[model samples]
Target chain A: MHIDAIQTPAVLIDMDRAEANLAMAQDLANDLGLGLRPHVKTHKLPGLARRQVALGAVGVTCQKLGEAEAMADGGLADIFLPYNILGAAKLDRLAALHGRVRLSVTADSAETVAGYAARFGPEAPLTVLVECDTGMGRCGVQSPEAALSLARQIDAAEGLHFGGLMTYPPLGHGPETNDWLTRAKALLEDAGLASEVISTGGTPDLLRAGQIPVATEYRPGTYVYSDRMQVAWGHGTLQDCAMTVLATVVSRPTPDRAVLDAGSKALAADTCGAPGFGHLPAYPDAVVTGLSEEHGVVDLSACTRKPEIGERLRIVPNHACVVSNLFDRVHLMRGDEVEEIAQVTSRGALT
Target chain B: MHIDAIQTPAVLIDMDRAEANLAMAQDLANDLGLGLRPHVKTHKLPGLARRQVALGAVGVTCQKLGEAEAMADGGLADIFLPYNILGAAKLDRLAALHGRVRLSVTADSAETVAGYAARFGPEAPLTVLVECDTGMGRCGVQSPEAALSLARQIDAAEGLHFGGLMTYPPLGHGPETNDWLTRAKALLEDAGLASEVISTGGTPDLLRAGQIPVATEYRPGTYVYSDRMQVAWGHGTLQDCAMTVLATVVSRPTPDRAVLDAGSKALAADTCGAPGFGHLPAYPDAVVTGLSEEHGVVDLSACTRKPEIGERLRIVPNHACVVSNLFDRVHLMRGDEVEEIAQVTSRGALT
Candidate 1:
């Protein structure tokens, strides 16, 4: 597509690359006997989620109820909201989704489960998976006893159904992970209750998927849009990444530094440990030194070649998931041509 | 409006507070005898820009052609883009805008000015201002000689008019600001030219604005939407700040921290050296320790109160300008009541 025809600071998706990445994950899941639940939160594009289902994903996973509702609206029959639902507002929305689609949600505390129960009503029991703090200390119960306590509360409650256990484990490799999962499973098994499903995964930990043998399902989001952080962290190559931010050089006021029109506004600033604003595939060495509201400063002094002002450049954002959440829609491109403008159905589904 | 009706991650602008802030800034500018050309890059809200104009602004300052178009659509008559315009496409867009409004743009290099000349034609000469680097090393020419050289290029060009001196003088309050503007004016006046319009201002340096005698205009974006940084850096108080992100606690897996539904998507990750994803109005001491794509972790272990799940909170974004540029529309409200959903008229005017 001619850069001038498209608006500046837009998200661009390569259909071929996206499809290939989707297929790769499906084949791996099928071969490994793992249920593929593609996290729709990464793309927030219903079309991408539909493609994942078509490629053999068991269900779509979302981080918020609003996102799950959007996916359901997009015709996904099965969805899992892997986020804690707290208020009556979201619980009401979740109840509505549960009635429409085959829905399951997560909860870490008794208060949250009780709150959901209060909203879902006594007769219409809502499915809930107890969350366990595997290695990520951000959320979930620390011990299996704590998990069972919440699970048992749900099991006894009138308006709640125990669906199993879930955890967003730390992205790592080797016996440390193997040991942790094994112990977690042992603890659950000793509780005299078999977990119908144990959900575990993230794009960063895809390499170590083999270690989590007890996990029946994997929820990987960034695999579909592998980015600078993924490539730098040794997760995926640049070509394997499907999504990119198409930006133009708005100002190069000096010889050493140039600024792009896409700043954190387009990028969303979830660096995820990457070194720059976004990667310039054509010029890999350039460093995005600073970002103002509408301006991104790229220090190209280190590069062998100079990039001119008004030049269109593809930036693989530091965090692909956050980048996907930035735009309302992204152009689905096939090579150098525009194919479609797929609405990001879950763009602002933060609730 | 019921907090539930106000969408999660939606920006709520307090009209009364916003009007007061606008009045204060315009009053400050009037008292100082400086032309108040309020920066449109901050609000990107036409209504706010009009209110500034009504408060006695010389003209509105736009950062992009699309922004200028939006302002013109809002019935604004004049705009100033204080940055280099590159490429035939962008220059053409600017030329088109000149028909609807009086447009004045900035250029730092000779090549960019030449492109402007090529695009605007003879009868539609583009109004030009040379952007200079005083202390903020982000953009503009380095020395007074360099500014003079670029100014001469604009003067020599067929479709370009030299429009005096401009500099986004470094962010802090100091004597260097006056020193640089004075020296730059001397250099221009020595070359048989007078610096008629001197434009220089940033929110941090607003208190010291009177120091620069040559500066005839002041452009400050963040004064309208003061944020956490502004409050921390002594720019404004929380009460004086007019905009905030209203989010819900979506996750409270641990007693120490809880994650909110509004992550980088709502906050825009514009952390300007302040702590936390956002500050809870009721709990300012809380720290936002970490943020995922859809989850913001608020640490309240040390604070006197813990944010329960489903609790609604207001966040003063790390940086306000970037947050303003994220959405298609911003909901204007007055004390828990949403009034209108105003389109960001210039949401993605990157080029």
Candidate 2:
């Protein structure tokens, strides 16, 4: 179905903009000679991931064990589970995935490393990357000595191989990125080991990706689908936004207020205290004051161009990543036509 | 699958509590000699509605046109659409629904009444009810005269029937409800119309439902699946809550903070300014400090216990109605075992 004919409150991806975004990232990586391992958590659709892979993406990175499983099932040859997979259930799934795909995952503890080693022997080896805390206090080993020791222990595991050192840096370009990687490489060499792939990430530092030394790869997912929040953070322009939510004004309760069919169920509440619910294409200054399950509370006072009842409008959500998880299907639209139906393969695969 | 065996971030419905909640509401209506038409929007699952129907519920009420259509598809004989059906799409669906089952819908304006009349003729009548604005200035006609005029327009239409008048007042126990309904009923009689039903609804005021004079029916959906918010509102206790989101702490980023697998995708963003993402049944004081799409940020500093990364948690979300719309399927749990799975009909069905 076309954009106008399809039901309201459906996710619409502009394929032309998406292709432009893909080409922009691939071109940047080509110029810098960096391996592009795009994070698939931002857009869980296998069709979009396949387009990225076709555009010379080296591999796809997963945020969870469940996401990795879906990726493998979607015929993804290279997979990277960036989170620490804890519990017997998750480790077993990881082990099975490793046997099926060229898989690698990160870890920061001996307890977790030993658990993986015991589950899968050296013959059915899984690549282990020691996650370093390069400033984002969310995960990984704190110091170089601690990280080196953990890497040594992980490398010595019968079933695991020390693939590399990776750090998901804080959302900015900092000196810690250089100091930590330099210190980490020295410590690994001192222990007679190699940090084969020194990977660093974060969209805030993506533009300055080439500045980080000894980095073999860069992974940025949201750069391909710029959102209002991303634009506010100076990541991309409104012109770069590829995905938008197509909604209709279902309820015109008042002259100043109109409610759209798209809500938290379709938009996915991943707001960082933004101005509007989604960036209104026709009225950019409108604020989404409130949201019900199937209703988007829009405050059109800023724009003063009130949308009439049954009026169709396009909205770019605050965060594109969260919106992908809310829908099982998204229309890949080009101009007036729907090019294809992209299934969000691992959307809500939060095991 | 049992609670422990099922994957994390799954929707769970305690059948015992659900049945108890239903029984309490049924008994309340029976003792008061009132007709109970439970709203299906809270727990879109038909199995729950079936149980309520078996418990002597008169019919079911739906908020949107799509929900009423879904209830009709599930073999529900009577349904009420309590919102204004504005658009041609919704109008067409409302007309289509009249062919399948006995349907009643509310309209606050003459424009809306004319639209409904144009769709369904007298053979398949679109029963129109005047929505009264008793307290909240969200929707509905302002005064009894406006309601009377709207009712007259519906009664005079070729394909419409002036069913009655409906009012969803703010949760309270007072004489204002009696005054509003009394004035509304007098005006309806003056317009030469006999209102068949005076449908009133409010879970908070269900106990005081008898205060309204000559009201024939009441709609209370949340009573069938009590939530933590309902308990906080003094409607029920924590022991009465039937629905919960079972999630696991996937990340323990800090000593005081951990992240659960359930986020906006499962719990939704329908706080209405509640305390946290949800209440932790096992740990009462622990609060969900923040929420991302797939990460429910929890702070355990004030609580007596700490959550392990893999430990399962049962979260009673702030609003039960919005939570049901998030999941496509809900597992019916008895004690520790899962009895069956009920598909969430009308999930993403935004007409």
Candidate 3:
């Protein structure tokens, strides 16, 4: 099917642009002599993950076990889940996934490590990365000492391999992040632990991955499909964005206001300091003033040529990762024609 | 399955609370001698829509043809789609639906009316409501005169039936809205056109619906599952909220910070003048400070009690309608027991 033949409020991925993005990220990682591990959360399609692997990425990073299971089912060998896993239901699934592939997970607390130790044995070990809070304050232990304490617990556990350390760096602060990681690695080495890998992730600071003193690998998710937030952070221009929501102007209620079929449902509501929900590439000055459930109210007052009713527009969402989770399937577009329709297999896999 | 057995980041509906909320709205409409048309966009489940019909709803209001089709498939006869129907693809589906159900749609302009007229014939006419801008500036004709002009166009059209006027009124403006509708109905009567159903909708103003002198019917969507937005609007207290997002505490990165498994993907990013994304009943003073794709960072600084890892918490989302569209299925809970797991059958059916 052609791109226009598809329905409105649909997810359209420019395959060529996506492939170019993949090549660029891999090239940067190669130039830095660091292993590239792209996060599958950005584009949860296994086809894309396989392409990333085929294009020299060592493995993939997943935030949830359901995502890891989906990728493993698609024959992905190495997978890293960088979130604290708790509860018997999740540990059971994690153990099953661990048996299928070379699995690694992150932990910042002793409780999470103990849960993993109870699930797996020494013969069949799971790599555990001590997640550190360099600066981003969302997850991970507070300091290098806290990270070493978690690493010690993982090393002392029965069925866990103390892999290394990982941190999701704050944007535009590569040097300070590197110093933190280096200090943590030095502490781990002094404690007679081998820091096999040091994983750092931030798409905005991806190109500066080489500068991180002891980092052996980098994981970038939004680098696969740069969005409005990424562009706002100066990661790349709008030209680097691969994913765009194909929406049609459904209601022209007034001369300055046009409503598109795509709203919070299609484009998602993750506004990373962007003025509106998404950026309309066709109308650069038109602001997505408001969003209801299925109506994107666009202010066309700034546009010299406003879009008419039924006219299609491509919208770059505020955050690409959240947008991917909104749709069940996405149209892989090769120019104006659709190459394939891939199901977002890991969508809503927040278990 | 029990309520605790369901996975994290799941949508849970208190069946008793839901039934009570439904009865309250139905009783209000009955006392006012107004036909109640509950908008199915909130629940999107046929079972719930059936319950609404069983209680007192004259029909169900839908925002899209796809939703109306889903309701029609579930044995719902009267389905009002208050959206501008355009394009041959949608009109074809609309024509088929018009034959199967007692279909009515809204028109804000001649273009939308022409599309409906071109699809249907006089033998099987489609009801077209002149959507008037009674001040909610989303999708409606600017004034009552424009509404009257569109009504004349619908009356002249061969395949259309001028049903009446409809307005999604701005909150707390019942008096002004009634005056606008009264004048529009008076002008229609002066022009010798029958205004059959003067429909108005707004959950915040649903209780004041009877005060709208010319309104014969009322449509209320979010009242079935009152959300944080409704509570903020002073429509009802938090106790009246039926739907809540059941999420698990995943991580405690700091003394004042905890993360839940639900984020934008689960709880949604729609902030209806609320400071946070959703309201936590357990931690009323706590704020959902930030949200990533799969993690909601809760600031527990103001709380005396903080949620522990693996502990489940119920969250009242900002907008119930948008939250309903985020999940594939919702858990219907009767106290602590899971009565049913109903599929959101009309989910992502956006054409």
Candidate 4:
């Protein structure tokens, strides 16, 4: 099968580009002497995760247990889920997963750690990372004091091992964020508690991971498939992008407007600081001005030669991770030739 | 199975509310004396489509050939795809579906009609509707002249039947929209061209669907599961919403911040005119301030009672259609009791 033979509105992964990206990211981590634990949440394909591990990643990081489960089924051994696991149902699943793989998770509060404690016992201990809020106000404990409190709680728990500290820092706040993590590690040392790992991640800050100094391991998801947002953030150029949504021009209603088969359902509605939903390689100036569920409305006003009906184009979405979740299977491409088809093993694994 | 036993971050459909909403929409269409053709892109469940058809819909409207195929497999005889059918791959699928069911589609240009004419023949004629731009600046022909031209092309085509006209009008543009459709129909009549159907749709304007006297059919998808946007648009109240994302509060990082297990992956990031991502039923005062792939951060500063870790809450998302597409199966609930689980058979059918 050739790349052009594959249906439109399908995810096309440039295998050569992805291999280069994986090697580049791994080499960057190796040069920095930081443990590379590439997040599998970006591609969600076990085949890609295996490639990442083969390229010298210590393990794979998963945001959801279902993703870890998929990876484990695909023969992955070590997994780190840096999200709070709550409820008896989820905890039971977590406990079962801990028995299967070398698993660790993160918690920002005593309540979450307690939930983890109730599930895993001393016989099957689970490593727990204390998520700290360096600057990203999304998740994690607010301050160094709160981090210590959570770390102490994890240490005291019977079935849990206090793995280390983790933070998804705000971009460009590396120095101060490192200072904050350093203070928390110092406080842990003062209390005679050992911090095993210091994890930090963000594709935008993957190159600067070594600058933090305190972070022993780095988890970067989007680095495998740099997207429009990555280019917009100056992480990499558009040529570095591996995954593209293969779409066909479904309608050319006017000289200024051309509609594509890939819409919000295919490309996703995530506009992570991009001017539009996605960037078209064939028509660089055409803006993806609007998207309904199944229609991506492209504004071809700026383009001198507008796309016609049935003209296939590749779109690099704003956020690659979200776009991967929107599809079930992705076409692996080597140049214009089709390499293989890979299942998005953890596409809807949101449990 | 009870509702609480179901895992977190699942799509839950309130059966009673859904039934009520379905009946209300059907009754409204009946009262309006307009043909009801509910769009199946909202739920993408065969059971729900069957229910909608049983309620009095002339047929089902689909946005994708994949969706229409799913509906056809579910025993739906009449399926109208109001999206421009482009490319030979999609045309082959459309033609195969036409042989099995009474399939109709929309075309906004001559190229799309030509594709249809090449795939299908008079024996297996496909009903083609000229998609007109009723002021929604999306995928539609810009003017009444354009609509007439497209309709004339469909009529001239050997394999296609000029079905009628269709428009996804801008909300509340009934008078002028009717004037435009009426003028186009009059031109078709003057040219001895017959338009058997004139369809218009928008959940926000479903109540005023009859106001457009030229429209012979009304297609509304979100009415079955009205969302936060529906409430914001004054189409319905919060209680009328049938679909709710059952999410568990996984993290309470601060007194004011609580993170739910559902994020953009579950609730989706498609905020359709709502202030935040969704509406929390348990804590109406709380705001869904942030969303990552697997984490929905809530702001509880305005609330007196903060959500604790492990507490499950129901969130009504801003848009129901996109949320439904995010999940694999939707749990049917009967007043806090799990009734059944319906597969989203057409969820990712975006071809």
lDDT (C-alpha, whole model) for all candidates:
0.79, 0.79, 0.88, 0.88
lDDT of 4 by residue, B55-128 (tens): 89999998888899998999999898998877777788888898888888998888888888888888767899
| Stretches > 4 Å off in candidate 3 | none
Collision count of model 1: 2
Residue A313 displacement in candidate 3 (angstroms): 1.7
What DockQ score does model 2 reach against the true complex? 0.38
DockQ of each: 0.52, 0.38, 0.67, 0.73
**lDDT string, candidate 3, B1-351, tens digits:** 988688888899998989989999999999999999999989999889989999989999998777899999998989999888888888999989988988899988788898888888989889999988888778888887888899999999999999999998888889999999888888888999889999998789887777796799999999999999998987888999999999888789898999888888778877877788889999999999877778888999999998887789999999888778878889999999999989886676666
lDDT of 1 by residue, B1-351 (tens): 654587577788888888888888888898999999999887888898988898899999987777788899998998988867776666667778888888888877777787887777668777888888888877777888988888888888887788888888766734686787788778888886676688887886776787776789999888888777777777877787788888777667767777787777677665655676666777878888777766777888878778777778888787777777766678787767777888787664455
Best by DockQ: 4
lDDT of 4 by residue, A228-306 (tens): 9888887989999999999988787777988888888898888767688999998899999988888899998899988
Model 4 spans with C-alpha error above 4 angstroms:
none
How high is each candidate's interface RMSD, in Å? 2.7, 3.0, 1.5, 1.3
Would candidate 4 be rated incorrect, acceptable, medium or high by CAPRI criteria? medium
lDDT per residue as tens, model 2, B72-121: 87888888888767667667777778778888888876666767877777
**What C-alpha lDDT, on a 0 to 100 scale, does residue B31 get in candidate 1?**
91
Q: Score residue A192 of candidate 2 by CA lDDT.
A: 88
lDDT of 2: 0.79
